[model samples]
Target chain A: MSAIEVSGLRKAYGGVTAVDGVDLDVAAGEVFALLGPNGAGKSTTVEVLEGHRKRDSGEVRVLGRDPGKPSGDWRARIGVVLQATSDAAELTVREAVAHFAGYYPNPRDADAVIDLVGLTEKAGARAGKLSGGQRRRLDVALGIVGRPELLFLDEPTTGFDPEARRQFWRLIRLLADEGTTILLTTHYLDEAEALADRVAVIARGRIVAEGTPSTLGGRATAEATVRWRGADGPQVRRTPDPQRLIVELARHEELAELTVSRPTLEDVYLDLIGERA
Target chain B: MSTMAVGAARGRLELREFFRRKDAVVFTFALPAFLLVLLGSVFSGTVLGDMSMSQLFTASMVGAGIISTSFITLGVGVAGDREDGTLKRLRGTPMPVAAYFLGKLALVAVASVAEVALLLAVGIGLYGVELPADPARWLTFAWVFGLGVVSCALLGIAASAAAKSARSAPAVMNLPYIGLQFISGVFINPIVVLPSAMVAVASFFPLKWIAQGMRSVFLPDEAAVLEMAGTWEHGMTALVLGAWCVVGLGLCLVTFRWTDE
Candidate 1:
């Protein structure tokens, strides 16, 4: 069964529509990413699913329960890592994690969750004293301490350094491997490609495209560009069948500095969002 | 775990967080005692034949101190929690809403007790203000303290929803508090000294009744002659404070929001 199912989900703040008739389905144990620009309804949609928001109209079944009428048991089954949280500054990481564990019927060990987030060394330190990346890890530690079956990560690595981002990706992969279904929202195309099994591009409160990263917006079947150093000068050609063009050129003449490239996830993502590269 | 169990755990964490912040501890606990000392020293004269001005201020200030710990501390704390994403994170978890409120009640109860103790110590040690020797007066103190803390704490939580952010919470909470202290006779001795209109206005608020209840406990029966109605009016005190408890709870139910949205 799908972990999440939404159809015709519509929400508006005052006269401004934040999410307009968006539909989504996330199967159990799958990593789904919603990619969008700022104010593109990514967070709004995720908040609705997390039961932190009330939708104007739609049907949403998260883990087979309506999120709008959330219960403690329903909340216990899902974990959420919100964007830009700076709470729990006074408590040490260990205390904060342990305190949250008591809220759920089944919880992961506090120490183990701390180690999983690579914050074991700083477990005794106050959350307020941690750097930005370390604080984010603490947020993640609190998020997963309950051993939730489904996790929602909203732009989890927004301000991380490259190394920190890579470590966070590995942790996400580890969780995904452990059979935890995850719903992620991000502006980073590389992050979506690295972590999401399937990605959906949201633009102006609607899903513009949805598929596996390689095939999203037809990236897998899109035309390729071939380039080489010709006798006249540099040469470039765009073609759906790049192999045939490469063979034709190789048989007729010597191709110097030859290269062939297809669209990257970022390229397709940018095109889907109507942004120029 | 049961919701009450989780609430108890939350209470422990809330206490840890509250004591860890040195500024909050000092400001919330020490400010009232400090003000009492400064004011009591300045006004050493007697209001009645045996009742000194410092003694009158001491009794009234105790009531103010309780409000400080409950109303101001809670207003600022709740607003800070909202601004810093603490409420949002708690809402996202399996923690029940009742559990969160129970935690706040625990924090306010503990802190107000400590604050009252500090003010009483300062009142007795420095100002020569006497504690009630009669068991009946002690009973009055008990009920007054209980009702005052509940009513003020509820109003504090309700006021937090009106504050735009934590940065503005102190101003939002303190304006009414300081204003009430003056008109309620905490700063001025002899409840009759204030303008009759101002006294009437203060009579409508919990602070005036709370101070009157405290005075009834600490002051001699003869001092009742100086009260607004020329009596302790114990029945009136209970009625006003009890009514405030209901009104404050109604306001809290109407105004409270987990987030600004």
Candidate 2:
């Protein structure tokens, strides 16, 4: 069974439509990324799936139960890592994790989850006293201590440094390896590319594109740019086949600083979102 | 885990949270003890009608402690947590909201115990206030203390629900907190000193009842003549406090939002 399914989902806050006629599906054990710019309804959509927000209209199922009216058991099966660090500032890292662990039916060991988040050394430190990156790791520790079947990470790496970002990616990969389905929302393109099995881009409350990262918006099949220094000082050409162009150029016996390039996933993503405007 | 276990775990963690903060521990638990000392020493040989000044001051301060600590502290604490996203994180869990409240309530109860104990010990040690002679009066103290905590804590929850931001939390809590203090005789004995309007207003809240009820328990029975009604009015005290608990809790449950509106 799919980990999640949504059809014709709609939500509005006052008169402003946040999520409009959206549909989505995630197969079991799949790692899906929801990518969008600010105010693109990414959070509103995710909140609905987590049963934190009510939808105006939709057929939504998470683990075969309606998220609109989630039972306690349904909540137990899902974990959520919010955009901000949890407000457990006064407690030690171990205490915060242990406290949340008690909320689930079969919780993961608190110490183990702490070690998994690379926070073992800071386990005794107050959660509020931790650095920004360290506190985010604590958030992940609390998120996973419940041993949830599905985890939702909303902008999970927003405040992380480059090193911290890489470390967090490893933790996410570890969770996925343990067969925990993941639905992540992020603004960083590289983050989505590195961890997402599939990604969807949303703009102004509507999805603009959805596919594998490598081929999203036909990025893989898109025209490539071939460039080299020639008699004209420089030359550039666009073609669907860079290999053939390179082969033809190679016959000249020399090509100065020759290079072939394709539009990156980011490039294609921007164009897709721009197309709507 | 069972719901009770979750509540206990959260409660334990919250207790640590309560003590770890120098400000929360000092302001919520230590302030009343400090007030008892300062006031008791100043009015060393004075008397308010039939009661010694120390006895009256100690009784009134107990009501003030319940309001300042349980009502003001928890009011700001709850508002700050909601503003900063702590409560929202708990909302995502299977842990019932009631369990979170149980943790908060437990913390308030413990703080109230510490506050009362400190004030009583200091009043008896420094001044010459006497403990209740009758064992049954202790029972009245217990129930009145319990009910006072409930009434004040619920008021805290309701205030937090109304607070729009952490910055506004203090004003949200202190408005009613300070208002109730003056009318309820926390800073001074209001038995004969309170204007009729103040008496009428304070009658609706639990703080005045708490002070009067505690005075009946801690002071000699003959001291009851100093009260406006010349009696302990135990029934009215229970009724008013119980009603506040019911109404305050109802208001909180109905209006409390896990996320900022």
Cα miss at B170, model 2 (Å)?
A: 2.4
Interface RMSD measured for model 1 = 0.7
> Lowest summed-lDDT stretch of 10 residues in model 1 chain B?
B21-30
Candidate 2 per-residue lDDT, tens place, B167-186, comes to 89888777887687777777
- How well is each residue in A182-248 modelled by candidate 2, as lDDT tens digits? 9999989999999999999988888888999998988889899999998668899999998998898
Top-DockQ candidate index: 1
Residue B33 shift from truth in candidate 2, angstroms? 1.9
For residues B209-241, write the lDDT of model 1, one tens digit per residue: 999999999989999987999999999999999
Docking model 1 quality class: high
Q: In terms of docking quality, how is candidate 2 classified? A: medium
How well is each residue in A93-172 modelled by candidate 1, as lDDT tens digits?
Answer: 99999999999889999999999999999999999999998999899888899999999999999989999999999999
